[model samples]
Target: MNDTTRTVRLSVDCMGGDHGPSVTLPACRSFLDRHPDAELVLVGTEQALAPAAGWARCRMVIASEVVEMDDPVEVALRKKRDSSMRVAIQQVKPDGNGVTMADACVSAGNTGALMAVARYLLKTLDGIDRPAIASVMPNQHDGFTTMLDLGANVDCSAEHLLQFAVMGSALVSAVDGKEAPTVGLLNIGEEAIKGNETIKRAGELLRAVSAAGHINFHGNVEGNDIFKGTTDLVVCDGFVGNVALKTAEGLAGMITSFLKQEFTRTPLTKMVAMLAMPMLKRFSRRLDHRRFNGAALLGLRGLVFKSHGSADALAFENALNRAYDAARNRLLDRVHDRILATLQALPGAGTTAANEPPAARHAA
Candidate 1:
């Protein structure tokens, strides 16, 4: 359990997302009410932060520019230097007094733009080549499955996948209190010979790391295995992970819509729905995508979480809570130690040119 006495400060991009401050301000209010030891720094234009003017445990940072939801990564990086998104991420850095400005940052802005700005500002953690987006998804076993590379890096090498596994293991261990989280390499099939060259090579690396007592590798798992809770963490390239995530979201929406239509089709069915309203409510809550809106951009030197662009107040609140949890648990430190240990356990792992790549030489 995390220490409840310590305060967790979060910087929020209040002018990002479709609803902008309208959604974020209310969410902040609710989040503050729920977490007494938490503080917030809302970054946005003056007008956008009017609603939160006199809130306790919250302050406003004036950002001149606003990053639109459709803003391109280049535009956000080059044009909108003072955008709310960038300002929020900037708060994650250490101050002159050597104290961290904020524990974490949360934004519901353009995904590509957010990634670009975050990478430029926070940079990657030691032993991390590229940062990956990781989030929790509900599984059939009534527990959660954490999947990574959710649209961060579309193309990845075997080494990148291995890094994702190491990072993902640390995340689940820190956040979920798992001693050694089980990792599954996402593949087309469960067979050892099923994936492409990159996946097969990644599997080999994962097996080696598992043998070294770093991670609990569960062989390979298919797409269905994600929902089956076959493993605590699922590793894949961003392209496949993004597709799987969006597909699951779409399927959940479709199922909800179909159920609504069926229940209202006739008076008898409507009566049955009313009779089973409690069960329906429970089912709807279980499948609500809003409950799982926050996705952590892992492997960064500082913490940054992304919320769905279309997230409402409730959804945004969940994203804030997720960020707060990560900060409170000192997730960054855990990830750093795990990655260092994993790198040390590799065969012939040294700083020599022939032993490892130049980029990975100082990863530890």
Candidate 2:
């Protein structure tokens, strides 16, 4: 039997994004309407969160400061201790009784600040080195391909890539309900020998873990393989993953812009576009980056998702949906189980579970 009545709570940084409460408030209201068993803890300044005061199943956590979009990670982490982003993440931290105020947290603030604050507040899970930003992209099969290390760690070693694969597998298994999803090492070619030494080494580790019945390693995949849906998940360093993500978004934008130009170029083109309106609309929606707005900061003790700062109501709502789904499905537990099961198989891993241990510098 399926359990549909489980209550899931979320702590949202209402003042984190570009539009602040204006966008988040509307999305929060819509999310509450869709999920009756869901609750929200909105964190922000009193003036910013005034509109949500009367919302049922919602509580406001007053934060004195709002971390600016350009605030340095150091400032956000040190100076603004009471920033909304920090406070929202704090909601997911377990209390003395091992109970958290909220099951998960969501923020559309500065990416670096979010990561720093989240790590400072929740810390990394045992057997996990560093947290990676994992999110989905639309694939050729009309499904999503999960990719990680978007921008969390600019430089990642082979061990970090393996850790990302483990965490990503757990995320997909928990949220997408795939027990053993395929994992792909993003490389220049399908062959394992194509990438640099780091990727090549990561491939060997992934294959070893797969042979042990841990993850379903799918060898190496090219840049185009991401959209080809060649595998269930793509593992790459933050630099490469972030570039791939931005390129995909740019391509989507180009397609939309091209369609609009064709529709308004001339009367005949307009008629042609009118006839193809339904198909074009479907294509547009399929490639909309806004539909996939939330990026999970994996390998953490608690759940924290990052949304695009420019996300509108629809996009922010989708981020909320992702966070809610992960929390309700117990993604944290799944990640812990996966890492613990495979920790010993991979050597020199999980040495950086502390906030910023010096030993992490020597991780493979």
Candidate 3:
């Protein structure tokens, strides 16, 4: 059924995460509770969700088999014809057209499996070297930081990084509403000849691409500058981005825990904590990972947001909101068109990508 008369429907992979329905069910409930205009298609065994969900009545797509987190990507894909991750993607497929007219899919399952399934089912858009996972990191400033290839692909070349820079630029523009967001190359130092060959090669290529006005490349930035908002977008390989993100999350938890312990150590400290409760809460909210769980799998034909496995009801709700923002912004379309436009202006304007239209390249 059409859950709303306004926004598009979203397919939730109910069986893909560590907490499974415990996390997924509450999230689905929270999403519908807030956004009545968004419809959802839950993909997982009714039995699996029955215990966790109190008989949710959203449009349902029964996924008979579930690939557990420990299962291998290829092995799971081979057996589970009706797995939650696979079916969730099918609903968003333009060919399938099962979930209204939305160009999106979301899953909290095995990171590699989700990407593999999406790549096969959704396919990549034209001129997109590869699909990169784009994420938002809260900045120390009033705004948020953006990064791409956040574990979508472990290996990346200069061309891939160049493409990522372009996608990351557009994402920051659309998500942050920054017209010309500064894009940075994730590197060891500010010098032109720093780090390994890949970083050096990618660094030089990004400079050329940015010089051509594809993006506002901000040379090179150290790991510490990520939270400082030195650049609006940071382009890096999945390995580095993933490790950095995980470290930041761990540090946030440690910081909060330490504060709690210190505040309860003495009556005076407790009194001070009570007095500064509001400011502390605001600061904590800014650091909360729930608001930042969703990551967009960009360079694909559609919008696909991946949330953390431990994501609770709030994170799932935010994931839905993120999907709505991306779809309405025509994000993928804008990125593809921009890429083609840039390619057409190159020396071999008549070669490679010019022959195919945006829709044609994305038309799986």
Candidate 4:
């Protein structure tokens, strides 16, 4: 066992992703090699964990079942009680001795199922009504922008967006070391009057929080503003956030394919490509999505990060690195503190106020 004060124990679902153990086990090996103070709890079937047996700093937890990439949320929650994914997340829960089994959990599994299991098992933090998925994206300023609700809660209230801003701010602050990260409300335009009633209301709530010395709200921002690094954190409902994220991913893929096609079009182009290989490689490295592979399920009592189901070894390793960083930084505690502070500052708008009288609380 590592004697370092910063040792982080991470639970990994070895059989959850597209390539299963073939991808995750190698990624675990690479992660352990780089993080000497980190330990891993590899959760999967006995046969699936055979390759990881010889790895140092790793302990295997046998699971009898596997959750497929396309399994429905109901099936994962109800049928697969002993699935590798569920078992991995279970490790984040406190054991019979009231001690946390792991610092955090990482999984490249069905997004819906992971969220369902995590929420059901670990539950949300003190003042957060719902959890949001926050991920870092590359920006024009050579820094990263964090965006939240990236497919966790499709329908959100203005209050939910407000809570998301708090959680996103806490996440960026903890992981990126930003003392007070700026927040932007994703909308149709930069003006105050744009977007639906829900967005306008959300903006109002964000401003209120800012005035209360809770968040650094930067008003409204458009889709293009995301790449410009207009704010360190962006908040939106899952429906819109998911659409924006997928669109960006599709555009990146298309651009890469186009460049490849053009470069291989002719011998003349191939010669030019060889001449510019150094510059092209640098550009590719900067925009590679693998560098930002993990998305945190913020607001949970315990930390849980979701990786792309088809992530390769490098990408999976990046996900593990992100989880390790969050755990080391005490992200869960930071989020809880921020939410509790915000609730205390606002008098009648208590934490439970948002959940009670659902219609009135959700209305724009």
| lDDT of candidate model 3 versus the reference | 0.76
Residue-level lDDT for 105 in candidate 3: 69
Top candidate by TM-score: 4
Clashes of 4: 0
Error of 3 at 47 (Å): 3.6
Model 4 weakest 10-residue run by lDDT: 355-364
User: Per-prediction RMSD in angstroms?
Assistant: 4.2, 5.1, 4.1, 5.8
Candidate 1's residue-wise lDDT over 78-163, tens digit each? 99999999999998865544356688899999999999999998778778899999999999987899999899999999989999
Query: What's the C-alpha lDDT at position 171 in model 1?
Result: 84
Tens-place lDDT per residue, model 4, 109-198, is 989999999999987776778999999889999899999999998999998999999999988987898979999999999999999999
What is residue 77's positional error in candidate 1, in angstroms?
0.5
**Weakest 10 consecutive residues, lDDT, candidate 3?**
355-364
Q: In model 2, which regions exceed 4 Å deviation?
A: 1-4, 347-364
Model 1 alpha-carbon drift over 4 Å, by segment: 1-4, 95-98, 349-364
Writing each residue's lDDT as its tens digit, candidate 3 over 1-364 gives 1222445567788887788877787778777777666667778897866754443436667888887787788966677778988888876666532233345667888878888888887778777879999888888896778888888878888778878887877776666667688988888898989989999988877776667877788899988889998999998998898899889889988988999999889999999999999999998898888888788888876678887776777886787678766665657666776677556544553246633433311222
Model 1 worst lDDT run, 10 consecutive residues: 355-364
Model 2's alpha-carbon lDDT is 0.88
TM-score of each: 0.93, 0.93, 0.87, 0.94
Residue pairs clashing, model 4:
none
How much is 338 displaced in model 2, in angstroms?
Answer: 0.3
